[model samples]
Target: MANQRGLATPLGVEFAPPHRADRIAALLAEQDRWSPADMPAIHTDTHLGSAAPLLDHLRALKNLSPKAAALRDRLLAWDRRMDAQSTDAAAYAAVRGAVVRRLAAHPAFAALAAPPSCPEVLLPWLALLPRIAFALEHLLLAEELYEIDRSAVVAAALEEVAVLAPAAPWGQSHRLAPWRALATTSDDEPGLAGDHDCVPCTSSVPGLTDLSARGPAARYVWDLARREDSRWVVPFGASGVPGSPHHRDQLPLWVRGDLVQVVTDFEQLTKESDV
Candidate 1:
């Protein structure tokens, strides 16, 4: 909505906004005059600034368990970026997932575990675990009503994470797994860099799988100043046919976060009769 209103620009990075409208507005004002050449910076901005609050909260807490302390120190030392090769991101995600799961299972929240008598479409809202997983930050900072020992959960989760070491980097696990109508085996899909709140959002359900099943199906940068200067790219190619020349031609570009120039000239395209 902000993009549509010219209050912000869509760089094809994050899907859900961080709810920081004021901050985004400031950023928009700062980059009001950005040109098409600056689009690359927008596309590649994968900083995890949104996670700072949670990190700061964790650091300020006292009497953390050894494992939790170690995890906190490692996260604090991190560059605060969710780069593809970042091991810190992987560790952080693992610990966060554990914390969320443990919190959801607490006796205080047991009442919420029962499925609500709502319509099937609204069933997800009644799922207690996912609610905790998605709104972890809020729950962590919010006033505790149910008297749940959040700190204990965090520590236990950290200890568990330390026991079960995740060897892969963030990108190796946090990959883009596009759903295909026809089941096909291919290892060409690229591992992505970014979290649910990062600029380049490659969100996944923590403690489950890091493979992102949802994202921009197609990315585009429309040059309102000059339509001919616009650029776009799809995950695959122009053709839907299995063995067509255009099939999967754009895969390489999409993986690299590159876009192709939009061709508006009909004369440049060959006629079907010619083919």
Candidate 2:
């Protein structure tokens, strides 16, 4: 499960140690035998199950204004797939961002706004917005309100997003934005599916940006039965030689989470040198 969790990391969801170990152990124990064909399902089992409780609470909020109620209903109706084309995911993101931003600026959390005196490496933790964004679930559901009306914040956020957010697919804004060795002509990349907490997590820094700065650099499935049946894919391609046909050839496959089969048979090899 460590290996599977590692693969899932690029997608965004890093299962907590306790849950990760138990879940994977349960899955393994349930299987009589495992095959390469079963690897994909095991690896991609990331579902946004974490958000259900919070979503249910949001749906049950009392006396939401008309616009807020409408947005809430839409969210309730969402399939929670977090697919690249999901507009509901985009809407959720917008609302979440707005709420975090508002909370960060609220006087209730003023003391936390001060930058930590610790090292620069720990700066992200000291940032107020990130802190709020990461702990939003707790903030929304906390029994003891911090003198701030959480319900009002959600309603306002929903109304604000309805007017401010562009009508576009979630992937239009949430995409792979990896740091490149060389500057490209365009920043345009493929639309991604999944969320920060999902199995195929495509999470960006919440409250900061929607553009994904981190994701799976590569994907692979090793076949114990037949080594040749193993498959792999990198963000770019197999060949490192620039100007070669193989350069960037695997990109589309990578984008689609597909893999190329490994070839080990010498008979299938194309000899480039006489030995």
Each candidate's number of clashing pairs is: 0, 2
- Per-residue lDDT of candidate 1, residues 159-226 (tens digit): 78877767679888888887677786454678887776664556676655678875556767899989
lDDT, candidate 1, equals 0.71
Residue runs of model 2 more than 4 Å from their true location after superposition = 1-46, 115-126, 184-187, 239-247, 266-275
- Candidate 1, 173: how far from true, in Å? 0.6
- Cα-based lDDT at residue 126, candidate 1: 51
Q: Best lDDT goes to which candidate?
A: 1
Q: TM-score, each model?
A: 0.80, 0.77
Q: Candidate 2 lDDT, tens digit per residue, 189-271?
A: 78777666665555576677888766666768888878988988887776755566776788778766677888889899796
* Residue pairs with backbone overlap in model 1: none
